[model samples]
Target: MTKVKVENLTKIFGKKQQQQVALQMVKEKKSKTDIVKETGATVGVYDVNFDVKEGEIFVIMGLSGSGKSTLIRLINRIIEPTSGDIYIDGQDIAKLDKEELREVRRHKMSMVFQNFGLFPHRTILENTEYGLEIRGVEKEERQQRAEKALENSGLLTFKDQYPDQLSGGMQQRVGLARALANDPEILLMDEAFSALDPLIRREMQDELIELQDKVKKTIIFITHDLNEALRIGDRIALMKDGQIMQIGTGEEILTNPANDYVREFVEDVDRSKVLTAQNIMVPAITTNLDIDGPNVALQRMRSEEVSMLVAVNKKRELLGTITADAAAEARKNKQTLHDVLDKNIITVEKDMLISDIFPLIYDSPTPLAVVDNEDNDRLLGVVIRGSVIEALAETTDENEVMDNE
Candidate 1:
């Protein structure tokens, strides 16, 4: 389901051209020389259109003065549009009256800003519960919900602490918790982590990703940072002055940018690291052998000329993996090769980014299998630590080239 949709939206600020001209003439300043010579108000947004899918992390990205913030605020009805329509869950919010707009806002949307808008006098718990309390939720229930929200935000220990008592990240977490506590259908975040330091920003980014994995709320995040948009958005809408330049999935935009502006914005991103097994896996030969056999496995390993083998049981469920060293050691010990084989496997799904394989490469006991998680134990390919490091190096080189270009 589409959670929010905007169509032909436009916002114009300041006095109209004709009015300004008439006022200038009356003040004996000047007469309008021509309509083309007349300057009207600024257009904050122009003919903007897009739809946000339910449970998607949709991002609106642009440079400063590009109307991203205005668009978000307009969607929440904080600012009225000059002309256009906004639909939330199929209802045109642009048509809603004062009370109706308030009702929709109360029930359908929550927003987080870069500034943590916590009440200075209120404790963290109270701040989190403020929205629910305003909506007239019973005190006990709202308190419990606030506590759960704090726990989810990893601020349970600071429940009684005031906003000033916490770090910037913690305060932002509280703001997020406050938004989530309302359980609104949509969450709008406007550069919510932009004010934090680099390390804290990355921490918040990780926390937001983890939280999204669990909560999966429909979010429309506004930001000017390209890297941040790529990290968090399921799809990105690139905006210029009062207009959307392009809209596409991250990979689509990265690989096939709509114009030179978007290309330059993403040109320096490490393409290969962003690639997953889905992008690089190749077909390979395999053989089935008994786990109790030794001589047969050695002959098979040598004949295949492969360094390792993916292990599976009779049902083809992934059991473990075997390496050349284990096979040789087993042969020397006069034991079944399976006896020396590693039963632990560090692996990734075919759909995951190759970047996701880094921790496993650093931490795995053996080479990791790239499996098609949708299918049971189906081997996509295998990735050793060396291959991933090489990929990283290549990506670095590619980035350097892009920079130099």
Candidate 2:
């Protein structure tokens, strides 16, 4: 479901008359520079249209002055749009009156800012419950909720401490905890991690990714860093000069840029960081362990022209792997394939980054099995060493290589 949608969203910063003139200029397809020069109005976000799906991290990214921050503010009507519709669950938030918008902000949306917004005087728990406190939730109940949120972020022990006592990263966690305490439907994270040190930023990024597995809120994250966007965004909208340059997955944008600007914007990204095992894995050649005996497994390896086969049950749950030597030994001994199955085969989660898969694939004697760790270790695909190298080199299709060994 689309949790939030923006259609032709435009925000102009100027006097009323200037804004009106700029709006007309925009309707005339006037360029951002032309509109500014003609009407003395700055177009903050230009005709932006995008929908954020439910339970996704939709990142809006660009360099400074790219209007990414302005675009995010427009979504919640913080900076009122000059013209356009901001729909949250189909309700036109841009059209909502002050009190109506307040209710929506209070109940549905919570924003975490670049600065760790916390009170110096208040305890972490007190700061966290601040949102619920304003909503007139019972004190005891709000405290409980706040504590749980803090606990989820692994900061419950520090709940009694003031914000000043916590490190920058810990303070940010408190900020995140405070946002979650409200149980909002949408999280607007505007450069939330940029203020942190590099190492801390990455840790927070990993924590956010991990937290999303549990909360699954519609997250509209704004960032200036392309790497940060690719690492966390389910899909990314790359913006420039208050206009969107392109919107796509990291791989799509990297491999097939929409324009020259986007191409240059992502030209230097490390492909290994953007590509995951699932992006390069081929369909796994398998032998059904429950049904395929040693001879049947051998025949599959012969026909497939491979030395091994991934073993799986009827349900396609990964069992192990069987090498030609192991298969042949089982055949000579008149034993089932399972009797000689190599259950020690290395398996990688489908979402593992190619960078992380490199050492494991090259160092291993067999291709790594890509399994869905969340799905009972169900076999998804296989990632061979050649596939990993070819993916980094950008010379082969993701699912093109099926030469499993």
Candidate 3:
């Protein structure tokens, strides 16, 4: 389900005739600077469209003056769109009157800001309860909810501490806890972590990712940092001037840019930091140890044109690997594959970064097994050296060997 949908949304800042002229220019697909110079009007956002799915972290990223901030504000009607539709749960938010819109703002969504917008005079628990209080939740119930939210954020012990006493990161946690206390369906974050020190910002990002796994809220996060966007966003929209340049998964946008502007925009990004094992892993060729004899394993190897085959049981668990030499030896000696299987295989999680994988793949003699640790160590795929290098060099080939390229 789509939690939010923005269609042809536009926001222009200027007088009446000038705005009309600018909207026409926008429809004519005029450049933002040209429109501003011609009509004496500024186009803050122009015909932007995207959807945020349920339980997604959808990021809008760009440089300083891109319409990312304006676009986010337009979603909740903080900034009225000149012409377009904003849909949340199939209702057109742009057409709602003040009371209807106010109700939606109170119950359906919450926004977290960059400056850690906590009340200086209130204690952390009181800050967390602020939204619920405004909604007229009874004191006892609101207190319980607020405490629970704080506990979820690992800040319950600091409930009595005032905002000034907490560190910047802790204060930001209170801000997040406060938004979550409302139990809203959508979260709108605009550069929420940009103020913190680098290390603390990273910690906050990790915490947010972990928190989203538990709460499953639909989040639209805005930021100027590409690395931050790639790390957290399920999908990203890259913007420039007043329009979106491209919208895709980080890997998609990095490896296959939509246009020249997008290609130039992402040229400087470190691909190793964004590419993961899943981006480069190819399907594993395997042999079943419980059923397959040595000849079966050798036949599979020969068919796949590989020196080895990963060995597993029916459950697809990562058992071991069987080399061509071992399989041939087993066939000549009349032995089973289980008797000659090598269990010392290197394994990595599917999400492990290519930067971290380089050394592991560089030193290992064989390919790395991409396994799901939480899922009974199930074999997901195999990550070969060529695939990793190709991925970092801005290519996405899911085949295992360099010779395949």
All candidates' TM-scores?
Answer: 0.77, 0.88, 0.90
lDDT of 3: 0.92
Could you arrange the candidates by lDDT from highest to lowest?
3, 2, 1
Residue 74, model 2, lDDT: 90
- For each candidate, what is the lDDT? 0.81, 0.91, 0.92
lDDT of 3 by residue, 1-405 (tens): 998999999999999899999989988988888998999999999889999899999999999889899999999999999999999999999999999999999999999999987889999999999999999999999999999999989999999999999999989999999999999999999999999999999999999999999999999999999889999999999999889999999989988999998887776677788878988899999998989999999888889899999998989999999999999999999999988999999999988999899999997888999999999999999999998877665533222233365
Q: Each candidate's root-mean-square deviation in Å?
A: 6.8, 5.1, 4.6
Backbone collisions counted per model:
0, 0, 0
Model 1 misses residue 79 by how many Å?
1.9
Q: Model 2's lDDT to the true fold?
A: 0.91
Q: Which stretches of candidate 1 lie over 4 Å from their true place?
A: 15-38, 283-346, 356-368, 374-394, 402-405
Best by TM-score: 3
Tens digits of per-residue lDDT for model 1, 60-171? 9999988899999999889998778999999999999999999998889999999999999999999999999999999999999999988888898999889999999999
Clashing pairs in 3: none
lDDT of 2 by residue, 278-362 (tens): 8899998999998999889889999999998999999899999999999999999999988998898899997788989998987
Q: Comparing candidate 1 with candidate 3, which one achieves the higher TM-score?
A: 3
* Pairs that collide, model 1: none
Candidate 1 CA-lDDT value? 0.81
